[model samples]
Target: MFVLAAALAATLAACGGGGGGGGQGGEDVTVASDIAYPPFEFERDGEPVGFDIDLLNEVGKRAGFTPEYQNVTFDGIINGLRNNQYDVAISSMTITPDREKRIDFSEPYFNADQSLLAPGDAGIESVDDLGDATVGVQLGTTGEITAREFKDEGTINGEIRTFDTIEDAFNALENGQIDAIINDLAVSQYEAKNSDGNAEIIEVIPTDEQYGIALPKDSDLRQDINEALAEIKEDGTYEEIYKKWIGRAPEEIPR
Candidate 1:
């Protein structure tokens, strides 16, 4: 874990840029993203396109400024924000207290939790059945933290392989290098469903985590972004995007 964090920190330091609030000081409102987590932020035909990307673009438009997205490593996003290399980040980033201390977050734009993807015949009915199986999770994500916790508590007795991207973790699972991969429930389900029998989503770990757009500490853009978010939700744009990407709207997307 220390090694992973160190690598992530170095990655963060390499993505240096200026930041500003709104359109202040002639600085662009740059948004940093990993661009590898699919159905959230991924490259579509060499262009970033996903729920978070679309949502934030609209947020920027409504807030009276166009946003510039920078592709940063997932582990480096928060650090980039802390250093103000980017003005905001909407990279399916979970809102946690530790992150809240380093930077502020917009009201959650999406709710999510961990999911397990494994072969159909793996017999892994739930997260509990992985006592002796290797598990895969993306580096610096909640899934990695959860997997580590499970290992510490003896819930999973095998190794936890951390990959740089969900695709890599999924590939490891499909190639039999890992027993299962833990990731965001929706993305896990999407990948499994699209895996052509290579994998299946076995369980959804109900972490009740919420994803938010990250911002520099005390950033005044918070209120503006929140206001735009509220407008989108109230005006039905949010539901449209949700349905287009998630296939269905939830009971409610909490503000």
Candidate 2:
């Protein structure tokens, strides 16, 4: 099934003329997203709905294009962009030097940090407490990268498991299959809040990362998207979206 999907994406990429003629008119722009991370991007009533979706829709309106969303796994998003499988991506992806080498990004949109989530009674207070406990993280995310860093530095003296999605990692933690989960702070908090005492955020790992709208390297649409993003931020649309999805007004908007 995965192979067939990949083939279809490739075929679509080859035939879609790069998915929108460089932001001209109201062209349908192909968008790639891991549609399971809530508050950022997720599915509701069989349609994608979240901060990223709302923000991107507004962006499209101003950028003169319509975004045609494509649901995909988080790990595959970057590779898909590199292969021209999608025109843009807005999956709460952090802007990093390494990733910048492979793809371009609009200005930073959301500030973020890593967090440690575990059962409420796990007795884990911080990363230092997980001596030999299993740590779960979503595959290819900065959370996974942070976990590996801890393991390499002897901070985490245990197995580091990778899940296809953050939801999967949360399930493992809930089922006692893993001791804890390392993931984005906001997403972890969302899960913990909805867990009904099953889980809680044990610690916030401060990385000072920022999310950005990803684009194909050297994409012509970058300028249009960035301008639209700037407009959204300036006219208070960004704040409204932030408050709606994040449940509070942003303390500071990412630059």
RMSD (CA, Å), each prediction: 7.8, 5.3
Residues 135-164, model 1: lDDT tens digits: 999999999998898889888999899898
Residue pairs with colliding backbones in model 2 are none
Q: How high is each candidate's TM-score?
A: 0.88, 0.91
Local distance difference test scores for all models: 0.86, 0.93
Stretches off by above 4 angstroms in model 1 are 1-27
lDDT of 2 by residue, 124-221 (tens): 98999999999999999999999999999999999999999888888888899999999999999999999998999999999999999999999999
Give candidate 2 misplaced runs (Cα > 4 Å). 1-25
What's the distance in Å from true for residue 244, model 1? 0.7
What RMSD does model 2 have?
5.3
Cα displacement (Å) at residue 200, model 1: 1.0
